[model samples]
Target: MPISSLARSITGAGRRFPPPLARDPHAGCAKPDRNLPPDRTASVIHKPHILVVFGTRPEAIKMAPVVAALRARDGLDVSVAVTAQHRQLLDQVLAIFGIVPDVDLDLMQAGQSLDTLAARILTQFGATLDARRPDRILVHGDTLTSMVATLAAYFRQIPVGHVEAGLRSGNIYSPWPEEANRKVTGVIADLHFAPTPQAAAALRAENVPGAAIHVTGNTVIDALLAMRDRIAAQPALAAGLDPLAARFAGRRIVAVTSHRRENFGDGMAQVAAAIARIADRPDVGVIFPVHPNPAVRPVMEAALGSHPNVALIDPLDYPHFVRLMAMSVVMLTDSGGVQEEAPSLGKPVLVMRDTTERPEGVAAGTSQLVGTDPDTIVNRMFALLDDDAAYAAMAQAHNPYGDGQAAQRIARIVDDAHRR
Candidate 1:
């Protein structure tokens, strides 16, 4: 399908999807009703007051569509709260969407531990909940902010709407805290906004109430489309990217993004080696957006640092990343977001982790989950690099996660639920 055609189809379908429920945030927590079937329902008497909360860059990207949807409803009062967990990067996403937070906790500190980040979000979110007194809190994806914000909402008896909910790796430790975060959020969220059928199935197997779950697709595609539109509209950005686009016009561009805890030490070294090897080839140029984490920095710098073909730069803002993905030959990453994003761009992805929660991508034949071993990373990199048939097969596979417009669908669901 033509890129514009596919984008329009996804967005159009998304805007028409109906949401299952609209929850009131101030409603006190009720123990799961064991006697009622998941399909059991009650009529809504009022439009919900929603407070959307997030801290990291990914959460902001995904939540922007949901926030926009909530704001369109005349009766629903919407507010955005940022914990500022990642500080600068989080603000970048907010600014891109032109969203100003009603509350900014500013919890970021240099080199803060995961524990510290979670604790700070919990404490500040509790204070925000008490003061704002919104009827519902919306938290996106699986992050420290997602978990702590949900917990704080639960503690305050505020209902939670979990956007991009019900993702599971089966093994909690594979994605470290994230797999566990989504699992815990499931237990507390009154409204579950699942992005895919696979995610909905996972929630059902775990016995989460089906009445509470809505398959809203993903919001990242909405963010990407929004960014793409912005880039196309801005002559300066479009002009700036032209030279870079022209430089690698015909040669394949490999986009690499690695910043995972499991892949930090030896794994990062392996990825770096693979990047250096890929860079050595005249046909391949790597655009690596380096994450700011200290653990990932040295390994990335030491190995791929001096390579002429690899462009090692600071972590890119959303627009640049989207543009890069759109133009890439293939993607190599440990990030959960990229796994979903690449296929929308028709770019094959090699996941650097040992396992993935997004089996939809793999099942669709767009992604390969290669572990962090040096040999495996190098082998797969070359599989797509050297083998024309393999590269074409992976690149042309259908995207299971989305075509785009995930955000628009999510917004429609929230808006319709409110209307009902």
Candidate 2:
């Protein structure tokens, strides 16, 4: 079978997947109902309202599965809200998932500062929360939008359910405001849906009540698996990737994605330099979905643009990216979600960051942190390319991030909590 068809078979779209086992390694919380509905006695009461909020493309990709799961349940009334922090990118994911946000704050500006963005999100989102008056608010990952939106919900006294929660890099400034954003959300959120046992342990160490934290796995896998299936079933969904697929035919393709704010200056230059060196190999082809940010685009294009084997194209939509991942030999990224998703596709990932909050990937042997050092990046890339055993080890490692049933588990947990 072709690679795309094989991916479809693995995903098993339109069929129900088995739920993740309700075993919590942290030993603080009770086993949640695996597939049970809300308590029958509480059915007479009104269905709980869940307002799902996200802004950036990554958040939308991770949160879309949770929103779909909540919408599928009978016990929950689900609504979506987007801050549009990354307007075009966010909309692309929303369209892929067919999610129509109940509110769009349109918070993006040409050259907005962090302080200004935070203030706008807090103000606009606060009013939206007041008007909608949802029973609970759900935020995904760590963006300025997630942090400020959680604060808005807190001010309204509405409980916040944080998806992909409990990630910590220890150093608050390493990932810039992301570490602080998730930490702030962690401190304020009422219900935390941690992606791994390690993440849950981090929450426990911080004195968060065990009952409030549930190991639901990461929702990014759910979104990834779904998109892979869709792209496979309908090849047209992957049209954006066809040119690269044809261009790199019979060659080892390395998919590259690096756009973290911290990797702006010297870090980006080093990454570009590394890619230039990697592209010199005749057998390898590099497909980089260059971020449009002024900090990244100019540096990357200047460094790698003239290279025939290096294709630095515009950012792709969800389906297109999934297709690229499905076809690639390996992935090089600074993206947290990519670290998690690539392992599931049995693709080895070389992380470009110095530190990562998703240590579960590294511990599981599915990914390695190469940082932004040009030598480090190039050496790691060559090892994966030249050493068959090294590549297989990382590709075949267990994906600790998820099993694609995270959204279902989160929906069931939310239903059970709302009834109480």
Candidate 3:
């Protein structure tokens, strides 16, 4: 079937699934099977049900590996539910990963506030939990979807397994609601999959039981390495990047991505100005995939759109984005996942945020925080462009994220928990 048709079919079929809880949550946790042997052993040998939930693009990217891993197990029944908080972007990642969510909340609405989004997710997901009643629900990262989904499951008395938990920026408002979202999920999740030792320690400091936390390296690396390999083998997958590759030719490509809500107005303009200035160098070229947000697109286009060497294009798909990172000499971004991903490809990163929750990249010397100050961003971009030694230092540093076996570790952990 055509991709577009398949997507429509999935969306249409999703709505036909039983609406959230037509019955009580605890009324019938399990359905009887008349064909099964009438013995205690047979009754006890039922497969465990695991429901994995996520809403946005980042959550889908990080959770795709876990979903795949869980599905590969023999005694587990896995289902996926997507809130589609970011309808188009979320669908892009799902298509790339070939994930068709069993339940599509379709919760996105124009100009919706955080309170409304949270209320809708809780109500709709609460019904989903009652209908599915899986043994456990797994949520990923720090989105509002993750937090409220956990709350919904908790209300139904179902356990939540948090992936990429235990990250703290020490300030609640710096990263806005994300820092608080992750903290709340940490409080409620039964299993915490910390991406690094530091994250695991953070959870321990919160007085969370050490036994519940597992340091399963960031699944982003697993997704990155896998995508990189697939792109390498099937070059057509990265055909979208071919045009930019031809356009930049011999120039050093500086790939940029900045759309953090914290950097909305002034911060965004400064970063755009820096990119415009950095493009003045004849030997360097800038390829920025402009975010679609009104606050972001206008500033970026007004500032860098006229630069001859800068190409301000729409957002690239996952494989194209990975291909862009692989082809680039450096990356500048305020994204959390990029900090973890770019390092694996040996690309030096200059963070556009003042403080990062994923400081593992900074400590390992793979990424440096330059904030949104145009002067600082310009100076750092120049140093990486002009000074080979400085660029090499960051490019050659170790990626502290993972060794690409995170999904296996997470799958084993979940299986062991179920067996116990």
Compute the lDDT of residue 199 as modeled in candidate 1: 95
How does model 2 fare in lDDT?
A: 0.84
Using lDDT as the measure, which candidate wins? Answer: 3
Residue-wise C-alpha lDDT for candidate 2, range 98-210, written one tens digit per residue: 89888888989978999999999999998877666777788998999999998887777678888998999898987888999999999988788999999999999998888
Worst 10 residues of 1 by lDDT: 4-13
Deviation of model 1 at 373, angstroms = 1.6
Please give the lDDT score at residue 388 for candidate 3.
92
- What C-alpha lDDT, on a 0 to 100 scale, does residue 377 get in candidate 1? 76
If the candidates were sorted by their TM-score against the true structure, best first, what order would they fall in?
3, 2, 1
Clashing residue pairs in candidate 1 are: 14-409, 25-135, 25-136, 26-135
Query: Of 1 and 3, which scores higher on lDDT?
Result: 3
- Candidate 2 similarity to native, TM-score: 0.89
lDDT of 1 by residue, 1-420 (tens): 111111111110012123324444334222234565655422122345678888899888888877886777555667788988888777667766789888889998998899988888888888877776666678888888889998887777777778888888889898988898888888888678888999998888888878878887787877776777887787344343454567666678898899888787887888888788778888887877787788887778777767767777666666667878887888999989988888877799999988898999999899999887777877888888899999989988987776466656655665666566
**CA lDDT scores, all candidates in order:** 0.76, 0.84, 0.85
Among the numbered candidates, top TM-score falls to 3
